[model samples]
Target chain A: MVAKLKDQMTPAERASALARGEKVDRLPCNPNIANGAARIYGCKISEFNTNAKALAEAQIAVYRRFGSDSIRIFTDLFTCAEAMGAKAILPEDNTADLLEPAISDLSQIDRLRPVDPYKDGRLPVQVEAMKYLVDAIGTEAGCSVGVVGPFTNSFFLVQMEKALQLICKDPEAMHKLCRISLESCKAWAAVVMDMGLTPTISEPMSSCTVVSPRVFREFSLPYLKELVDFIKSRGRGVTMHVCGQTNKIWTDLADLGIAGMSIDNVASIRQCKESIGDQVKVLGNVDPGSVMYAGTPMDVRLATLECIRDGYDSPKGFVVMSGCSLPVETPVENIDMMMDTVREAGYPIDIEWVEAEIARCKQVLGK
Target chain B: MRTKEELLAELARCVVEMEDDSVADVAREYAEAGHDPKEGILNGLIIGMNQAADLYDQEEYYIPELLICSAAMYNGLDVLKPLLPQEKQENEQKIVIGVVQGDTHDIGKNLVKIMLEAAGFTMIDLGRDVPVERFVDAVRAENPQVVALSTLMSTSMQNMGRVVQLLEEAGLRQQVKIIIGGGPVSTAFARKIGADGYSVNATDAVHLVRELLGA
Candidate 1:
């Protein structure tokens, strides 16, 4: 089902209109395509992530080829840790990793210096990429600078187990570490916002799968609310994402005052629509790991149709997106399948065509 | 003068409460008063960890609780290991575990290690971001009966498969079982990658290894 769009606005315009509660041509297709771009350009991910010029070129290559509704500048989850004085292992063809956290104990958390996004490891590379995108494609192109949310960044600075233990064992220290993370996020987001880039805060480990709602409310919620308020206070937009089963905290997330949300596949977009009632923009929830990276093109089409159908009738707006970051080796054919479906989906969905495609895809991607 | 059962129960309570510091105090008391340290662990410390594991199975305790309980359990282990018979220590079944290459998420792997050690399996933890070839080397060196592989990233999912193939090429596949688990791993992926078994939670990993060994 190839869609020849008659009314194709720039991705920036469509996203802006959708978030503003106005009519849109179709849902914006802006999955967080990070290292996947590195693969497309045939460059080592380690090199692509570190070099500003290479990062810009890879993003530009993806933008030109895919015509995805939005362009996201993502370095890695560990950039926040690396920026805060932790040593990171950046591999040749993989995402950067920091084995030892910045804080070995709670006492050290206070000593962590605030990161300057300009001079920090590869953060400037990210900001420059965002600048390059805005320059090359004009401001009409959708763009967001990705930042790690405070809750997950806490784990980045301290080991996940030790950090989580602090939640129940020593919540006072946990709260303080979260405050430190919040300060770091504000510092980083301010830099990107000053560059005219929207900051998208992603908390991959903040899902129900990792922390129960009680823990989330105590540790993650207030900090997130603060982050959103800070971004909004500056009169700019912010997007928030959590990587796995987040249905438990969906309402809290909707009320966090972000322009939009990106959810993982385990979260049903239909439920998300009901919970929020179109008060905020909803993006995402195709299983990036299983359906997009592992499954065939037909699986991608099926998953894309499922997300659209569930969220198409929402009150706020929805963008068709992968639930999370595309793996380093995500297949382009599957990506094209998602793009094609979004282009053809026609605003106020073409149910008849969609029904036909769903039926056809069912046959192709049968259980 | 507390009964033997009552003293052990007190020791068990220390672990269940996640009091790492006071657990050693209770162990020393149990030892000074003539209670067997090995039994202090088996019927005392291990029992407490077993209760924690049960709570974990019921979703009452999570990673944090388990880690604290493991800390308490290790506190008791440190006091009791010196008392265990040398023959008992030398003859225990061993298991090799690691987070596969390219994957650094080891909280799950660490949990499994804690549970397995509490269950009395000697573990050789290869640590996170482990090379694929090391699985074969560990299997060769440790002669362990099970090689457990874990990865949290989807990109590193293929490395689990590579470890399996490496075991096959090294002719060590049949000598020991391969078990895999993590966020992105599934039973289907395990089968596709030729792993012998897959368990989503760390608690179930002990059972999987037991079933593989017919224990």
Candidate 2:
């Protein structure tokens, strides 16, 4: 069955098409579909965070309605933490975050053990949701599963404040926590990849800009490399999403085993492409909150086009997207405007369209 | 009279000890020893605070440590301010700082506040989740030279922009440098929002503030 599907359009082919390195019918619209899906499917943000069924349904609806190539289900930050017996809080208006980890003391690490994703707490729900999604649309569309990075999980387990202290005070414990997070991540990645979907890890806290490069090297990169290799070894593609000015670390990330990077807007695309785009696929830099939330449709359009224009033109693996998660309240038309900008442009952005886009933005913002 | 080095050593000891009584005692000793208050702030308290900032950057200390040290510096400065000449007492540049509306993240803001104060800048912190009107009202009342706005979440970054625009509309923007910084704030976003300056990290924040103040 997989062979037959590959004969028609391979993963490389699909990746190539999205990257604009190869010619395709249209640009791939793959938003990091998260809580916005819940809002789209009429599930309250509260329910979306807490209820598995609501979360799954909303993700499906978002993929179907938006024609997105991929749908991201784990919108909340507390995925692996909750699985590890951390207390998580699901605020109605805010993102789901881990309240406290079960491992408050170094001695607790021995007591706490990794769980099978199918039998674990929220991990099971996420996997089950992915399985349902696979049965429904995974074969037809790209199904992306989100995983937390080692440092973030360490922060969750010991509580952020204590976790930060531990990183400086007890480097050994931090590494121990990272090891646990890495193992759990591999187990979790296996569950998602079994559904024949790609796996993407959101490394929100592991940015060199967030922590020192030395700390990242000590605490994050090793686990990241292990997890990326583990996921890829299972025959699934991996993309690591890091939120911050990580231009300095693009080469460091490329040196790791991930297939692609989803970087923030603060990091220069020209520099990232120059440094690591040849080796790995690069995904995003669109300012989601700035352009998608507040800017006019034209702002979205111009910025989207600029992302593609300044792109490495790596046809097979690049995916143009927002630098970070889509804000829950982001205007739908603004997203539409981004897609429209890309769709209107061919492989390369024509100069006339660039001028027209600039005009449109100026007109919208009245600048 | 003690040499400048002795006065500075005493001030450093006061910050490390972080007791109000010790800080006040050393502050009076420094003043009675005939050192300039502004010079004591620059050479003594500022050095200790920068050390704390360095400690934070190097992961040697955390927020609580910085806060307590800042409190110590403040305590010593309180005692020193009264004895100093009027001009020297007013020498520290005053700035207004706050987290923009709908954002409750104050840890980063307070870090900036402490670092600024440690750098010898007088800060009027409006605390977290500050409305735009309050920023403007504070600007009108306090007439600070720089208004530093902070927001952790990407969603509330718009409020920083709104505050800037509101200030601009009220014809107060030109009067103050609108600086925005936090986890989510980027230099490009700050430029888009028409902010005067943006810094990615805390140390850069101090430099940005000094540059804005032309100090």
Clashing pairs in 1: A278-A315, A278-A316
Clashes of each: 2, 4
- lDDT for residue A230 in candidate 2, whole number 0-100: 82
Per-prediction DockQ scores? 0.47, 0.21
lDDT of 2 by residue, B82-107 (tens): 76666645565778999887666576
Q: What is the C-alpha RMSD of each candidate to the true structure, in Å?
A: 2.9, 6.4
lDDT of 1 by residue, B131-171 (tens): 99898899999999889998888877888999999999999
Off by over 4 Å in 1: A1-7, A16-25, A48-50, A103-107, A350-362, B88-94, B141-143, B210-215
Report per-candidate TM-score of chain A alone.
Answer: 0.94, 0.90
Off by over 4 Å in 2: A1-13, A16-22, A101-111, A119-121, A348-367, B1-41, B48-96, B101-104, B124-147, B158-178, B185-204, B207-215
> Which candidate wins on lDDT?
1
| lDDT accuracy of residue B179 in candidate 1 | 94
Write one digit per residue (lDDT tens) for candidate 2, span A1-367. 0011111343335555655555564445455657777678886777754467777788888765665556777776677777788887677765765556767778888766665788766776676677677777735667778888777777777776566656655789888888888888888888777866677888877765556666777788888888888877787668888887677667788887678878887776666777787888778877777677766776787777677766636533466788888877888887666666655664444656666766766676676
lDDT, residue B58, model 2: 73
